[model samples]
Target: MTAPILEIRNLSKAFGPIQALNNVSLIIPRASLTIIAGPDGSGKSTLLKCLLGLVRADAGQIYLKGQLTDKNFEQIRSISAYMSERFSLYPDLTVEENLDFYACIQMVPKDRKDDLKHRLLERTGLESFRFRLAANLSGGLKQKLALATALLSSPEILFLDEPTPGIDPTSRLEFFRLLEELKKEGRTIILTTPYLDEAEKGDEIVFFHRGKIIKQGSLSDLKNQFPLLVFSFEPETNIFEAYTELSKLVGPENLILRGRQLKIFVPEGEELIWRGKLLRLKREEPRLEDIYFYFERRSEMMELGHDQ
Candidate 1:
């Protein structure tokens, strides 16, 4: 059996009184896209920073490439590139110049800089906009340029924090396509995003909430293991009013609003009760979002039980 490319064991971190990560452990395979997904302050970014040695964990061990080294961070940083939530590019620099600058920073040899720069430009589809100033580029193009810079070093592992937040859907799709290309080139990519739909594109997903991993698995594995039956329906009354009324009847955790449609998760044999209250009801397959919330609510209930 092949070993995991990266292994994190019993990782934990804290900030003053707040615990940022709690006994987190994960295994990442080579050449795969692993998404760390959760809401804001869920410790997704903290996990990435700890792995890259930007933030020190209070406890736990990180192993890379089947070995744990004394200079763990130094070795990891050498083979990794991180693009933070606020990836900065020189606004005044043209796209080509920006790439050139990062290439120099990554210490790409003088003899190979131009070839590497050109390849990245072509790969990111930024060759035509090479001469355009970074500040003038659209949000999506700006993100592409940031990715190009991160790739300048040809690092084996890429870490991205919320790389697609607020971008247009078209650009987000383009960015994901580039990631697929990188995976084909045998690069391990670990990223964090708040969007559950975006997390669907990952080879594996780790779901975090309030500094703990609630669940982790491949998309299909998660879907297959989901225990509840889901149904979508249109409420007969005003959507907001129906949601409020239904929350009292079925508990808020079981209900979700998707535009004008309502999605509810119920245990076995409880579908008929909800069906009577909603219109146009139909059984639906569970999505990533549904699975996430299911686990999240379970976690909350477990914690609540313990507290009581």
Candidate 2:
């Protein structure tokens, strides 16, 4: 693994009775993209905010570039950029104008400002849309502008919180392509996303659930660790009806319905039963969603046991 750019240890945060983060610790590798994946209300957003000092962690320390800076994040923030879940740039400002505004805010050197702006605009494919108001741009273009603005500082690490939600697939693809280029240029990216499909593209994934990281690893590593076999088949009957029937045989938590296709988790010793019930079932590789669902349920079960 590459040398770590950021190290977080025993981080915790709370909002009154709700614990937003619970004893979380993670090492973010240098020059690679590490995805924070989880559902809403999970600690993904809170974790990012804590790292950037937007929200203070109640406990634990954050080390940036191997130097502890829990009390002051200025040094870390200086070398990093963040794009919030919401579009933070001025919607009324033209794309180019927003870039200029952020550039000035980041204090880009006068000699490098114009050149950097021009290059980012071209790189993000926003050169032609430079004169368009941010509000007038499509969902995709707005995101592009936001990204270009974030890059104005030429950050070493970029933190994005759900950058692709509500974005069209085509635009999402373009946005990720730009990220890949950034990674190739040796920039570390830490992104929080609810979409597991998007998380699949990262070098490492940190899976969170209800204020804690339940799993963290590379895609293949996680897949190899998955203990259950996934059997998928298109239901001959109505999907929901089939799902209901299967729910009785195998818990609903073990089933995933995708359109007309039904996927079931076949336990180590139950392959024969599943295969007998679904004549056309085929064993398939588990997708990232499958892995997440499995871990989330397992975590919930363990929590229930502890409570009991």
Candidate 3:
């Protein structure tokens, strides 16, 4: 059997009184896209930083290529590239210049630099904007440029943190397409995003909440493991009125408002009770967001029970 490309074992970290990571362990197979998804302060960034050796973990071990050694740091540094939430490319330099500067800093051999630069520029669709100043590029274009710079070194593992936050929908779609292309090139990509739809694109997803992984699996696995039945309704009356009535009947924990529609999750065999209370009700497949919230709420309830 082939070994995983990257592995984390019992990893933990803390900040003063706050524990940032709690016994987190995960495995990344070769040439796959893995997404660590959660909201802010869920330790997504901290986990990525630990893998890059930029943030030291208070406990646990990291293995690369199935080997755990004291040289793990050196190995990871040499073969990995990280694009943080704020990748600091020189604002004054042109796109091409920024790539060249990073290539030089990474000590890419002078003989191979030009060919690598050409390929990265073409691959990232930055060829036309090569001479454009970094500060003047659009948000998506700047992100593409940052990715181009990160790729200059030709690292085997790529880590990204919230790479698409606040970008327009069109740009986000384009960026994900680029990532799919990179994955096809046989590089292992690990990234974090709060966007559930974006996270759905990955081969495997790890859902983090409050310093812990609540669940990890492919989309199908997640849906199968979800413990509730979901139903969507198109109300005949005012949407807000429908929501209020449904919230009272099923409690707000089971209800979600999506534009003019309302969705509710109820236990098995309880669907009829809520279906009778709304119009145009239909059983629907659970989305990644629904699955995430289910696990998150379950974890909270479990914790609360233990406290009591």
How well does model 2 score by local distance difference test?
A: 0.89
lDDT of 3 by residue, 226-292 (tens): 7788888777789998788888887666788898888888888764444454334588999999888
Point out where model 1 deviates above 4 Å.
69-71, 237-252, 257-261, 269-271, 274-281
Candidate 1, residues 128-220: lDDT per residue as tens digits?
Answer: 999999999988998999999999899999999898876899999999999999999999999999999999999999999989999999999
Candidate 2 vs candidate 3: the lDDT winner is 2
lDDT of 1: 0.89
> In candidate 1, which residue pairs clash?
none
Ranked by lDDT, the better of candidates 1 and 3 is 1
TM-score of each: 0.91, 0.90, 0.90
**What's the C-alpha lDDT at position 272 in model 3?**
42
lDDT of all predictions: 0.89, 0.89, 0.88
Q: Give the Å shift of residue 175 in candidate 2.
A: 0.8
Badly placed stretches (over 4 Å) of model 3 are: 69-72, 233-253, 257-261, 271-281
Clashing pairs in 3: none
Number of clashes found in candidate 2: 0
